[model samples]
Target: MCGKRWILDNKTLLREYIKKYRYFSLNNVVQSIGIKRCVAIKYLQLFKSEKIVFSAGRGFYTSEGREFIYPKISRVIKIRQLIIKEFPNLDFIIWNTLYFQPYYHHQQTHNITVVEVEYDGIQSVVEIISRFYRNVITESKRKLCTSEFDITNDPIIVRPFIRRSPRDGNEPRLEKMLVDIYIINYKYKIMADVDFWELWRSLFSLYRIDFSKLIDYAVGRRNMRVLISQLIDNAGLKEVIFDSKYDLLSNMTRKKGGRCRDGKTRHKTVGIIEKRNTI
Candidate 1:
């Protein structure tokens, strides 16, 4: 009876773990839970068969119905890994639309991937990627602005920007993704106003956004302060703005070199913050 109870409890624990974490590797489960490797594999197989969990490439698994559908960018992971292996000295951030998957629901019919590297190495990196994938083509700055679409060849947009923060592996963090999306929307004018707001609402609701990190990234960018301020107001997430550990409004004002508005002064900001926390 004790052995049977242990088995049942382990199964329940595994289910709860997957539900909370959303994704896990087989080794992660075995090491963290102290389950024997073979036993863990068997349990995982059972879970998969029962539709409680699903495989997410190799040994990774995610809870059923909760798995995020990463955007389709062919060989993205492999390409990133290869780049790191070949160029140990280079600093770059490689990601596709997969980073924004959690914020919006859409089919990835267009193949647009961005490879951002240091300012000097843009052409070199593009050449390297093209060598690896023969069909891939680099878009020129003029072409990026003027050309609408290219369905014939695989297009990899190469951009050179000053690397602000260290690469967080091969992917940018959520804060970086948000800032990038904001910039892209401003430059491309692709996302509709309603769609943009809906995306922001979904992101704020689903993720623990680091407002400080976001502000840090957006500080130097032109019109970013206004964009963020408007987003906060339009989302009706005034409570989030006030509850954030950093004084968001003051930070924006300082960045913009503007005097604080009546409701945006330090004392008023503090009062609003306190009021929201109390509620």
Candidate 2:
């Protein structure tokens, strides 16, 4: 572990704490978080990578000046966690059943975090994981992966690969089921960019993580995005679309009471004479 320390995930009052305030201001952003001023600033910098907020003026001001606005749109992490937490077991059920894949069990987990922060307000953090195969490459190309038709600029996103750990096998551990799911659904722009600095500020204050490398690498937003893209492929997603009309028809009709649709017009079967004869 690096000389830096990270806080353990705090299980208490996730909502109550978030609701009290929306963003932490400069006067408070540093003071509020226990980390040294420099470290706190570093965390805040990370949140900026997700584009959750921006500086309002010179010097530190608030989460707003420092910029820590939360996303207004509902995101998968909040939505899924909220729904699952209601049932307790249902939460794990949904995550493991739908989100978590078998291959994820082996690799380390990395979070694509987004934070929307405001100065002196409660800050929100969103974490996402890639649901597809993210191959590891020697060099990283950030912009291609991070920026996607305004997606990286969006309030929430990224295809965070499974956390990497020492692996005996050379194989890239990606979930087959996830590859299938991402190809068909839940695979758009990797939910790109959340407020990273706010998260560092907020989370770092309460807890700690070895974020030095992450902080440095994530600085170049485009580089981060491109690097992330290599881990997952958006091009392969086309496979989700059917190649044959027969397959499309089968998909449309195979379900019970599924919306019945026909691509081809039955020229002969719909002869007007048939209806006239019946009348």
Candidate 3:
């Protein structure tokens, strides 16, 4: 699609249009610019390279530099296809460490594929996956942290699905993946003493994270402490906290174990937490 062609004569008009609209889709650009979809896409890629336009999500663009890096779902698609071939009705989410490669410092040589299934179907899914793949561990916390289960060897960890996990279809949303990585690092030291704050900073700087959804999922996993710490340390993130609808950080600081104002634990669902206090 990015093949060499006549230089975009409409680049200035495209920039002005995006600046005025703030948020737009590919079709919107095509209609407004009166250009072929492929031609517009090629120009858009050029604009993105020049840091003139940013990806808000799939087929979505913004003038603001906050680019939303969508996870590459080819592997997830293949795994889902395989799982669906046998258990056509099973509920699961498939994600891998490779999605995070864009935000991290070093190019990761090792990858971990995480397959999360509902309680009853965990074993079945693991069994099905084990047939095609090696080093499959089923809900084994010890195995994840042990030397015997080398993560560098490309291991597959099957976990029980969290209720109401934030997702983009069958794969985790960026928010859910961020929370999961923090919790995984806390529990199993999976990232191996890597600087998490920097990791999160890179992620937040690159993607359009839904703070409310991220916090909600973190609370569900009982892993808000790490997030809270990162926010406290970074003044810019604290500003984001105030800007976001998720003002529960103050209340969270007062209450332990992710309790709400009514003294009940936070719900598993995202974007449902009511605002109580400001931080």
Q: For all candidates, what are the clash counts?
A: 0, 59, 0
Best by lDDT: 3
TM-scores of all candidate predictions against the true structure = 0.56, 0.18, 0.62
Number of the candidate with higher lDDT, 1 or 2: 1
lDDT of 1 by residue, 90-149 (tens): 878877754565566453344446677776777778778878775454444444532643
| Of candidates 2 and 1, the better by TM-score | 1
Question: Cα RMSDs of all predictions?
Answer: 12.9, 26.7, 11.4
Residue-level error in angstroms, candidate 3, position 161: 0.9
| Candidate 3 TM-score to native | 0.62
Ten contiguous residues minimizing lDDT sum, candidate 3: 270-279
Sort the candidates on lDDT, descending order: 3, 1, 2
lDDT for predicted candidate 1 compared with the true structure? 0.60
Off by over 4 Å in 1: 1-74, 105-108, 132-144, 148-154, 242-247, 251-279
Q: In candidate 2, where is summed lDDT lowest over 10 consecutive residues?
A: 116-125
Best by TM-score: 3
Ranking by TM-score: 3, 1, 2
Candidate 3 lDDT by residue in tens digits, 1-279: 343233445666677776776445676778877878887888789988998877654455656566456666575667788888988888889898788776666666777788888778988888888888888877543344355457677888888888879897777888888777776666556565455556777776655655556666676666665565555565246433334323345422223347678987754332223332111
Per-candidate Cα lDDT values, in order, are 0.60, 0.28, 0.67
